[model samples]
Target: MDIPLPTIAVVGLGTMGTGIAEVLARAGREVIGIDISDAAARRAARALEASTARAVGRGRISAAERRAVLARFRTFSDLRAAADAGLVIEVVPESYETKLGVLRALDGIVAPSAVLATGTNALSVTRLAAESARPERVLGLHFFHPAPVMRLVEVVSSVLTSDRAVAAVTALARELGKEPVAVGDRPGFVADGLLFGYLNQAAAMYECGYASREDIDAAMRLGCGLPMGPLALLDLIGVDTARTVLDAMHAASHDRLHAPSPVLRQLVDAGLTGRKAGRGFYTYEAPGSAVPVPDALTPSPAAGAVPGRQVASVGVVGSGTMASGIAEVFAVAGYGVVLTARSPEKAAAARERIAASLARSVDRGRISAGARDATLARIVPAGSADALAEVDLAVEAVAEDLEVKRRLFATLDKVCRPGAVLATTTSSLPVVACARATSRPADVVGMHFFNPAPAMKLVEVVRTVLTCDEAHATVREVAATVRKHPVDCGDRAGFIVNALLFPYLNNAVKMVGEHYATPDDIDAAMKLGGGYPMGPFELLDVVGLDVSLAIERALHREFRDPGLAPAPLLEHLVAAGCLGRKTGRGFREYGRR
Candidate 1:
């Protein structure tokens, strides 16, 4: 049976509360918005009006519709006025005492069957429910900040919350046009538990100078296709709220990963609570603004570059998926591409795979049939590394092992011309040792492309001290030619992307390991709570568990830091062959049962 949309009362008209109220009223439900004081209530009303006016100004809503929403919404000076409401959601400040008072007050006034929901991010929903007179009706309806826009809503059921209460709230969330995921009441619930833990780790990375803010962000945005980088997200979420949420999750879970990064606390204490305070991981233009001006404190770009190589042809070695993708990228960029494999048949198969991939792109309108044919025309398959001798540049997209990479570099050095630039597509191994295998060490640099190389944007150009200016310059030019953003860095393991991204993902794994929250909850937190494109665990599965563990191993080995060590959960998952989306299992299962 369909229940009519309940008249909703939003207690505590702060940013989140006001937005939620506006959303309800805009949906044609009568909304009673309350704050502690008249001034705050008036401010919330004005804010709601301004937001709706902007929608009208932008031509998204007509003037009459805007007026209807404003008229339907009410600002309450007294709690008793909310008695007529059928559902009351508390969006007060995240203080336990403040929330308790509102819930207790509402219990005294509203009908026993009226649903009670809290829009809490971190505090235990069960504990808050216990404080209410009608515990069975009290539950957590965790809304993402800026409640009018973000799509996700966590429908949390406390130990005492009734199934009917949960159903009503779920329906309400859907009525408000948001996706709802149900979870048991717990600290950080679904979103903050996973989001803050990762954000804290990113802050810790920034404090340790693992990578620059721009590169750290670029890694996730371009490398993983995330909507925003961790540091920048921390700034947007406000370091103060992030620090508090971290502290709360740590208190509840006692997981090291959930512990607030010392830098987060320091920044908040110093009055740099991200965009709200004009500074945090990066400085912002003003409070609540997303544009952050780079500060002097942020790291300068890596020094030095390699000179350009004058090769008209390029050789790409390997028969694996990445190898085929790399060959395709070079071919599409108009380079005469020579692809190599162990046997003639294997090389031919790799060429066929590249053709198939380009065919899909053509079908998707990303490329033209003529362009695909042109790219295929530029490719030639070789049976051995000896075929790379005539090419001006050779990029090895071989297996991610030191021994195999060393052997490949040793062979390339012997086969390729003296001045031909040598490059590795290794995301984790140090480029220096690979370069050292060749007599002209300066000729080797890393040209790392993300998975599905033809589609992803970032390419980390890692240059060792031994790498000559000409070699670095050549890779950068190649990156540009392939329509990739090339960011230069020194020859360190993990380079820029994995160096910063993996640790954050690894930290989330640890948080789940310690039972901070469920895998579903953790993933939701980052996607909803932090506005990331995908949750940390979701990314881990997509990147492959084994691949992430290898990168974590490289980073831990290079820094010798216990913090970078791969979580036991990751080791267990890898050992079980739950390698991620490829294997149909990881932090979360993928594909049909």
Candidate 2:
């Protein structure tokens, strides 16, 4: 039975509240927006008018419809305006006292049959409901930021919440052209449960000075295809609000990763609460403005003053897809590339793979026929590492096994001439381990490239304690030459991308293993709510669960933090040989190719 909820009131005319009111009014429902501050109520009114007017100008609504939308929406500076509302949604600050007080005061005002909802991404809905006068009528209606634009709305119901109230709110969400996902009353339901932990870790990564703010932001944006970097995202989501969410998550589950970073508290205390205040992790153009201006944290492109070694020729080792892709990237950038492997036959095949890849680019109009032929001509296939003697850069793209990479580095050290930069593309292993295998540790650095190197724009330039300044600069310069965004980091497990990425994947697996949510629902929540390019499970399958598990294990071993432990289900799947797309079955089944 889907109960109808037509007359709704949104208390607290903040950004979220105003957005919710707009959505309700646009859906042809009566909306009453209330706030304690008259100025806040006025701002919400103006914002609604501007938003609806823009909609009409875009031909989405007629001028008559815009007027009706405005007529159905009204604002007041008192809670009494919500007395006739069938549903009252509280989008106030994230405080137990503040939320509870609002619920208690509204309990006596609204009709007994009226439903009440709390708009909280974090915080216990059950606790809030239990303290309200009509516990059965209370539920959580968590809308993502910019509620009108975002399609996801988590319809959270506590144990005490009535089925009628849940039905009423759920139906209203669908009627408003939003996807409603019913969830149990928990601190971060599903999307935020996985999202905030990753955000917290990113904040911790930046706080410790492991990577520059710009590099961290660039790495995630280009590396993981995220909409924004963690610090910039934190600034966009007020730092104080994130701290509050983290505090609630930490108190519920004592996972250290959920513990708010010190930088968050420090920023909030300084009154630099993100874009709303003109500063947080970055300085915005103005209060509530998205435009970003230069600040002290912004990195200068010329900071790497060390001049890089001149490179005219490059050597790419191994016969895998990554090797072929790297060879193609350098060849297209006008560098002479020697493609070599342990056997001449394998090296020839790798070069042919690059030829086919370039041909496709020509077929698709990405490159001209002459350009493809010329790019293929630049690649020289060889069976021996001796061919790399004249190359200025020898990048080892061998197997991920540590010993294999160490042995290959040692081989490159013997074959390549002195002053030649030796680089390894091991995603999880420490570059220093491979560096120690070679006599010229100072000449070795990490040139970690993403899969399909020719397409992905990110390259994590990892530097070890022994790597020379020139070697580091050389990799950065080459990465730029190949049109990849290079972000520098210390020689550590997972570098910048995998270090922050795998943990989130592991937690997603845990959520499913614990029966909290299904893969489809979790996937939809992230794509619709968080604006991620792909859901965690979808990416895990594409990345191969086996490889993801290996990276997760490496991270856990390095951190020794209990929270970083690999999810048992991941190990079981790998043990059962249900590796992702490679095996045709993983978190979900895809038919055999």
lDDT per residue for candidate 1 within 1-593, as digits (tens), equals 43345588999887788888888998889999887688889988899889988999999999999988889988877889889888898988778998888899988999877888888878888888887788998889888877888878889887798888888888888888888888776677656655666677667766776666777777768887778888888888778888778888888767676788788878888998888788878887887787878678755545763347786899999999999999998898899999999998989999999999989999999999999999999999989999998999999998888889998999999999988999999888888989888888988989998888878899998888898778888888888888998877777877777776787788778768877566776676667656677788888888889999999999999988676789999999999999999998888778954
TM-score of each: 0.85, 0.98
Q: After superposition, how far is residue 593 of candidate 1 from its true place, in Å?
A: 14
- Judged by TM-score, which candidate is best? 2
For model 2, the run of ten residues with the poorest summed lDDT: 295-304
lDDT for each of the candidates?
0.84, 0.92
TM-score of 1: 0.85
The candidate maximizing lDDT is: 2
What would you estimate as the lDDT of candidate 1?
0.84
User: Candidate 2 residues 1-593, lDDT tens each?
Assistant: 55557789999999999999999999999999999999999999999999998999999999999999999988888889899999999999888889999999999899999999999889899999999888999999999988989999999989999999988888888888999888887778898888889989998998899998889989999988999998889888888998988898899889999999999999999999999999988899999898989998777667649999999999999899999999999999999999999899999999999989998998899999999999989999999998999999999898999998988889888999999999999899989999999999999999999988999999999999999999999999999999999999998898889999999999889988988888888888989998999999999999999999999999999989999999999999999989988999999898897
Backbone clashes under 3 angstroms, per model: 7, 0
Weakest 10 consecutive residues of candidate 1 by summed lDDT: 298-307
